[model samples]
Target: MNINDLFLCPICRNIPLSERESFLNGLNYHLKTYKKGAFIARQEDPVEALYLLLSGSVKTEMISDAGTVLNIEIIKAPKPLAPAFLFAENNRFPVDVIALEACEVVFLPKKSVMLQLSSNEAFLRGYMAFNSNRTNFLSERIKLLSIKTIKGKLAQYILSRARGNYFTFEINQTQLAEYFGIARPSLARSLSEMLEDKIITFKKNEGEILNMNALKELVVS
Candidate 1:
């Protein structure tokens, strides 16, 4: 992997090349690899470093007291891991980050990250923007979890992404089921019901809203 590419990750984007190189010069960092199914960091682990994924993907999941696993999100390479938690009062991993596949990551001690935040204006701006977006994402997740039915969750999701009466799905049903904490069959059944009710019409990877009012009602109800 190109070392310079590390400077292009989400938290480092828009930073001037010279300044990025300067900050990286003599920087203390560690590179680590994880195999598929490996737990990179378990819940409650200290947030001692800024983890920048260099390759592959991972899923952030939380296990409930009843041993149920709630999949929070899937993060691919070229992104920071739980950046918003880095400086929180409870500076610890809130979810278990497990490798979805073989992966490599760069670990920069929080002290070094703080130094970068202080010295690099662009870096600071990028960091803040990333965290702000993360906050919004979490808020949406909470809203999704609050909905009582799978149909309601599906309606909210589709309506959020729909452009006018048309929309495209980014992930397949299987992945989406995991993200929604439901079984594949259940999601498929809900979707079939929606189609049968004429609330939506579907094609491969895309759909058209046949009854916008119905979708909105499902979400609100």
Candidate 2:
């Protein structure tokens, strides 16, 4: 990806070409590519340059003491990784970022960030608005991860996407298992339990909610 691709990101949206060029010139930004399974940023790494994903996918993960890894988010291309952390007191990455596939990223130095923040009112406003949404997204993700049981996690996921009494899964079971931080067999077993309880019926990719109230109860209780 090239510098032109920066326009696709919300933070770079509507930024004037002259200001953009100056920002790039100040930092001497370069696009770097990483292969699959490469670590973009490790947990606790000091945050200096802001990384923007230009293409492919990256996963943010948190590893537990027991060696369990929970994938917190799968961020697709054409977006900034963590703009809010730029001004943080600790200024460190909280999660490990790895390339799920071949990917490209660009970074801008902290000096350039401060330069634009002080001079460009429009850019400053857009940057802040972008991080505000990020804060809310992180809050919701925290709630999702707080659910302890597999059934509860599955219930919350299903209810979030359910259209009335119907739900359809676009992702396959493997991806679902990875997202829920569970083994495929465990996910399959809990799903079978839901089927046995007659709370939901699913075949292939689509499912219909037979007992929405019961599914809701499963989430809270």
lDDT of 2 by residue, 64-169 (tens): 7788986787889888887778789999888899999999999888888788778877678879999988878667556767888889888988998899999998
lDDT of 2: 0.85
Clashing pairs in 2: none
lDDT of 1: 0.89
* Count of clashing pairs, candidate 2: 0
Top of the candidates by TM-score: 1
Candidate 2 has a TM-score of: 0.74
Q: Any runs in candidate 1 off by more than 4 Å, and if so which?
A: 66-70
TM-score of each: 0.90, 0.74
